[model samples]
Target: MQPPSKTTPFSLPVDSDHKATKFRPFTISPPHMRAFHLAWISLFSCFFSTFAIPPLLPAIRRDLHLTAADVGRAGVASFAGSIFSRLAMGPICDLLGPCAATAAFSLLTAPAVLSASFMSNSTSFIVIRFLIGFSLANFVACQFWMSSMFSNNVVAVANGVAAGWASVGSGFTQLVMPLIYSFLINTVNLSSSTAWRVAFFVPAFFQTVTALMVLAFGQDLPDGKYKRSSNITGQISKENAFTILLNGLKNYRGWILGLTYGFCFGVELTTDNILAQYFYERFNLDIKTAGAIAASFGLANIVSRPAGGLVSDEMGRRFGMRGRLWSLWVVQTAAGLLCFLLGRSNSLWGSVLVVCCFSFFVQAASGLTFGVVPFVSKRSLGVISGMTGSGGTIGAVITQLLLFSGSSGNYMSTQTSISLMGILMVFCTLPLTLLYFPHSGGMFCRPNYPPTHQQHYDHLLQCQ
Candidate 1:
């Protein structure tokens, strides 16, 4: 046997497969921390690429003469693409490992982002947005990678931070794209249209670069890249890809979690698509100002989502899965209330404050939702993650269609639609209260249920 890799000597807590128990954000050594950084950064680039257009939508709308219907359609299309791609990405991760799957996906999607500059009509804009949205599938890989690299005890924090940082790309692009647009118009002497188009090249380039880096340097498991026959510790290698996916699909918990994710992550996606435009139109703010405010919503993910995971993990340690469920329900319910208030605020500063709070809770709810995911089924982690991820996109699609779609013939005002969406979120949280696991129970279920045989087996594995 070959000698152990140099990075394997760290004293951090590790499990049977040597998956890390502690989450060190600054750590860059491979198989754990290195994978953490690469996973988040790779996902970050994809988020950036997918959302780069939203901040510039005002300009695109004017240039393309897009109606509100067209705009809503484009938003739906983007999430729709992500829904399908994320579903596919789960099994892909199971087959090739997240590293290879992510790299290949990024390379394939970057061209679509580049092609954004060519959008000349409503149809083309919607189609291009749809294609660019495929990059969000990297989210599944990011979460799967974190779960694979860290033990269950610290996995929430790992998943939270990785997803949180990756999501910052949405906020980062919101803040940066407008500045780029302004620079091109004011300094580079390009027209507004040309400048926005040129800005696409920036995210596309970064997406390509990050993809190449992951492909070259990223590790799939603690030991090495994934192999079909290799039995990596903490992972189920006996199951084929199809079997893995079917197992995940058959688990009712995955469906419940998917619905929970829809209201949290799905609402977040819809907000990202429309918030800048909302601020611009409602408050009469310039693109830069509106983008900046909207940026606060996405940027909140940096802290808010991780905080959710931290809380979930802490609760799990203290109160078991019931704690995780309570935290998810409480946070999500508050998010819905805040979301309702966000639409009702008449003053600009009030609106901003409510949105910031809403961001914290909604994103935190996302973190909490995923905190429960790894426990759903380790054997089918990828499929369950995919289902939940796709559920988020599906939620966005439904929200966009039901509320924001101007095709309603008698379109409700944007504010009213937003308020209505909040009510829906409140109703959605009800499902979380009903989810029960034989091992740890749920929100209203008995917390002291006797451990099932599988639970005992899992506990033994954790101890070993």
Candidate 2:
């Protein structure tokens, strides 16, 4: 067997160092926040690559001479890869570390991503897309990293920012990809196929570089260090990977959270892929114009998703575990209504406005769902996070399969179906209020002491 790696997990921090024993919800200097920063960058690369194809779909269709059914199948194919990849990654992050999990995915998928630039037919392109989908697992690692590095009280907020900011790539790509395509077309005098092909190269370069950065500088804990990957410790590594995965599968609450995610974050993913196409078809807008509208929906995630986390955290301060549940319930219910409204609106800008509102609540609901994730089982956080993250993929698949499928689903019928999906979101929120998650202050108030695994959080939060 290979010798034990030198990168052993750092022993727990000393308690006498009061400087390392407090909490700060809004600071840039803490180790947890540092981890958060790195995590977002890695997660951003994954999202950027995952979404790179959608905004360019219109151009791709024309170039390849593909049917609408082909595009819809590609969307399904992307998320289908995400579902299984995330399920498996939870165990990998447990065995490896977040930094390894994130970087490995980034570097491993790079060749497939770059090769997509050369695919001339729908079959090869769809296969390449499935390969790209593996990057979505970075999201699970991103959250697992944050939970390891932060306190329970503030974890939701940290998760919110990391997830929210990382998601900007999806929206930003929608906006940015078009400009790249346009620049190549208008300035460099490239054909539609060639211009779009070059755009994939941009994100491919960033992903490879960022993955290296994470491997070089990323940390698995908040103690300001990273040792050899083989030196890892913790619940993720405390038990066998298979046993840990089994535990996650048995945790029904996680399954419920995953279901809720199917609607909220699922809508985000589905919309990210289809919204541009919808605008292009309904308003007869050019790809650039429709893409801009869709990008607006994605950009809303910067503030909106974090807002949900902040709200959940505030609720936790006041109501403990119940607050997190309440916040998710209220926001998702609102999101469902907004989806209904989005489907009904006929005006060009009016529909865009509805999408923005829908984006906010759905994104917020996603943040709120995660607020409760870490609390599920500290030892199983990796598996739990992966399972929960997969929930979004499930939702996206349903939406595309039902509302946006090329042959069976049409734009004319979208409004009614969208409104119905909203109601489903509202109903999903109802059960959480009764489902118990151990919390502070007697379930309705802040606890005098923190929950399990929170002592380390306090240590990181404490300022010298």
The best candidate by TM-score is 1
Model 2 Cα shift for residue 6 (angstroms): 27
**Per-residue lDDT for 1-464 in model 1, tens only?**
12235665644667766788777887686678989999999999999988899999889999999998999999989999999899988888878899999998999999999999989999999999999999999999999999988888899989999999899999999999999999999999999889999999999999999999998899998878875443436454576777767877888888999999999999999999889999999989999999999999999999999999999999999999999999999999999999899889889999999999999999999999999999887667788899999999999999998988777596999999899989999999898877877677777887444655655756532321
Clashes of 1: 0
lDDT (C-alpha, whole model) for all candidates:
0.89, 0.78
lDDT assessment of candidate 2: 0.78
Q: Report the C-alpha lDDT of model 2 over 1-464, residue by residue, as the tens digit.
A: 11113542222121221112223434544454556777888888878888888888888888888787888788888888889888888888877778888889889988878988998999987888888988888899898887777666677887888899899889988999999999999999998878999889998998899899888877776554432222123212345788879978888778888887888898889888888888888889998898889898888889988888788888988777777776788888889889878878899889988988889889988899888887776556788899889988988888877766676445536566667667777776666654554334322444455677566544332210
Question: How many pairs of residues collide in model 2?
Answer: 11
User: Cα RMSD to native, each candidate?
Assistant: 3.1, 6.4
